[model samples]
Target: MDTNDLPFKKRNFANRFFDATVWDDFIYRNDDIVVASYAKAGTTLVQQIVAQLIFNSRDDVDVASISPWIDSVYPDKRSKLNLLEAQTHRRFFKTHLPVDALTFSDRAKYIYIGRDGRDIALSLFDHQNAARQDAPLSADKTPPSASGLKVLAPTQTSACDYFDTWLERDGHPFWPFWENLRSWWQVRMLPNVLFVHYTDLVADTGKQIERIAAFLELPLSEGRLPTILANCSLVSMRANARLYVPHGAGLWKDDGRSFFNKGQNSRWIDVLPPEMSIKFEKKAVMELGIDCARWMMLAGPVANASVG
Candidate 1:
């Protein structure tokens, strides 16, 4: 039977059961590396890049299968544990759960990816908008709208609320992005943990990929490195997303496009209003120790703020 065709119940147990099972039980072989990132903070991009670094060749290799998003609300705890226990190869699992919820094991290398929160906020907005209208139809977390454009004002919810609300309160399955980012960021100094910035990845995919490869002790062939970089490029990945997104496993309405949207930094340049930008900047500095002036320089000047 096709693994993709498995009964929905058996296929996705975690979401179905919700009775948190022992996730570690699925480890067939212990891996020295784990890549954790906030939603759309280049999680899939990093996964594909890491998979290529370790395997050297993408041929006949299903990148999705190798870097499975285990914590996603599909595989029940027992099933998840079973899968983890059954795997013998070095693995690279993906997760967005806060660190507190993660079951830590010594020796595993953990890499966390963080982006400027403003970009993250915009990405979340776009992603949420897409999910509301997309196929397989996940719940629409968007606030009701009269103009047909979902509007989320400050009075509504937080930057995290865009997806966290759907995943937790509405029982959508992915891990919460903000909590997960904070959880990992807090302990990034740990010997086994590495923190990567999304902007860094955008600025230099090749360099960042090498950094990740070295962290995992994975050797990349001379020719293989470039190939991997090209394949995981935003354009290529989006063009060939079927190889990565889980839902694209079969020939269903899956587009070979990547889940990654607007790979550029400062996409918030087009999305955030001046007042909201100030509010977000102040919040980020207060909450993340990231100064607004410094971050704005990184994200690019706010048009209104600069003039006034």
Candidate 2:
């Protein structure tokens, strides 16, 4: 496919953490891999899986440092590009931008991991609470954040309150949830795009990892599969949680080791108000349509999944 015919950046996206235009300067390689997600949507999990596949189960792969978040405004543009250019290995990076916000390329493979919005909300609540008060803590001296938009640690006192704000404001402190998910969903059929839901990953991580491997054209060897699976597990990742956080710069509270929370589904089950649950479902359908909204919280026909 002609690179000219591929999807390029449609719009610039700036938020507290990202300057989407940062990707514009990147030179895409056909073998490059980009992991796309809307934060806390099993992104690190996918990265860990890809790292395992790429290294064929290297035990000490420091994924966060190696696979930099290209869209982030931190570390400056020159440094980010320089790191990528210097890498001799097949490079894979992470992004929180929607497909349209990205300088998309057919040359690169994109895998998007989505979770139930409710689950993401619950997960993010825990995540943001642990962040430094100044927010997005950086141990090193760094340039100002993207767009100079200052984001403080979340002030919401309760999980329910946080959910209300997250839903009402359309991912307020972060990016738009529906649009990010919808953006990837629209281009999901693209040859380079692969969509893997959180439920699917939770239900059968090994299978999902295999599917990801197939998509990236890097099939795992039989012996590497177990090691890859073990490394990508929540237990394994949680134990090494400090290594997975962005920059591993003590961005998280208490050394960022607790970054990986319970990797289960329906965390917002009985915790959310009945009306709030209804509100989320209605908005999800209205924003993402029935198919996607239904797909978002599929733990088994509303039996296992409360949000459904």
Candidate 3:
């Protein structure tokens, strides 16, 4: 299948959090790995996993610096491009943009991670709150561009209020949630694209790691599996937070540890109302169809579930 021929819409996503257009100038290499997610999913976790795989489970790799978020608008485009071009090692990058927003390359491997929207809402709230607090004193607080595109705003502290805003606004301060999932889901069968659910990672990390390794064609020695697994653990990631935290923890008020807060899913079960939870599920079904939605939320078996 020719991915370039796939239908896509060009968007000027210049928001406080993301800029989709930065991808237009990106150059793809045959060995490049693109780690993607809708915000606060397992993007960072999988980045760490991919870093370990590429570096043969080395602990000293600075993933955050090495794996820049290419689509981010904060760092200038030329600098990021130059940094990537200079890299000799197998380059892996992060992006929050959906598949359609990106410049797809058949040669590059893509790993898209998904999580329950409820959990995402909670995690996003924490991330936004911390980011807001970390904002520089002279930072621009002006409204986003006149393109009528809504930038991500500070999330409410109350879980219920935040959930309401997120559900009502369809990812509010961020881009649309359902469309991101649907866009990636439609291309799940692509040879270079892999779909990984957070639930699956939590349930069987070793299995998922092996799957990722196979997808990336990384040679995994049995001896290195333990180190890779340890580095990817929540505790280890938090402890070594400085190396993996985006922008070196300066973007977070409470430091990088707060950004890595509690990797556990379902923190929204008690907080999210039953009706709202049902609404999220129904919306997922409507957008992604029952099979994809079921696999996303429950990590159930899907037909022909090959990793790569």
Candidate 4:
């Protein structure tokens, strides 16, 4: 494909949590790795995995600090750019923006992680609750516009209600879930984009890590493999949770450990009613089509696994 022919469309999106406009000022490097996902879709996990691969599985590395969320308005565009510009390593950054809202670069490699929306809804509930708890403390200290931070008020009382709101309203407290998934799914065939699923990662982390490493063309020695796998494990990530939590422990309800809460899938299996589950599945099919929806729901073999 012609580099110039690659799709590029600028858009503006803002909510309490994200400012997609931050990408407007982002400077992309040829070797840059962009990690994109909807909320609570194992974004941090992928970032941890990428950081481990780039750093050759160094346990002490601050993954959160090193892999900054460039689109976050907390530190502002100038501050993020300054930090990114000074980075000597192959830089990887985090974003939750949809494809159109971003400035696409043919040179950069993008890793897009997808999780079942049912699972994401449960995880998002905990995340929002934690943020609400932390909001008051930082409300006076941190300027509102600086972070685009707003304490997310719970729209529903229970997990079932929360899932209903999430699916019906389309990723309430964040952006539209369907659009975000569909936008990235459409670009899965792009050479620079790698599609990852949370279920697949959980099923075989080492295999997924190898896939990621190969996609990024990282030279992995047999000796370094064990360390990389070890560091990216759920236990290790949760144990060293402070280093991986965004904006540090102070911004979380339970001092950041809660941010890494139960990296398990199918939690919604018990929580959501059968009808609600059926509703979500139907919506998924409507938004993402049968192939992508099935792939996303199962997180199994990719339906269209042609991209490098």
Candidate that would win on TM-score: 4
Model 2 TM-score on a 0 to 1 scale = 0.91
Estimate TM-scores for all models: 0.72, 0.91, 0.88, 0.92
Instruction: Give the per-residue lDDT digits (tens) of candidate 1, residues 1-308.
Output: 23332211112222331232334344434455677766667787777777777666563357665566666544334545555556666777776655655566554678887776567655765554433223333212222321121222222444455434443332233333344455575676666677788788889888898888787778865777778877877777766766776534222233534255677787666655566666655544454454423432364564445321
Go through the candidates in order and give each one's C-alpha lDDT: 0.57, 0.79, 0.77, 0.80
Clashing residue pairs, candidate 2? none
Candidate 3 is scored at a TM of 0.88
lDDT for each residue of candidate 2 in 168-205, tens digit (9 for 90 to 100): 99996666899998888787777888989988998898
Clashing pairs in 3: 152-173
Q: After superposition, how far is residue 103 of candidate 1 from its true place, in Å?
A: 1.0
Expressed as tens digits, the lDDT of each residue in 65-129 for candidate 3 is: 98988877656667678899999999999988777677888778899999877888888887767
Question: In lDDT terms, how accurate is model 3?
Answer: 0.77
Stretches of model 3 off by over 4 angstroms after superposition: 1-9, 132-156, 299-308
TM-score: the better of candidates 1 and 4? 4
* Residue 58 CA displacement from its true place in model 3, Å: 1.1
Descending-lDDT candidate ranking: 4, 2, 3, 1
Pick out the ten consecutive residues of candidate 4 with the lowest summed lDDT.
Answer: 299-308
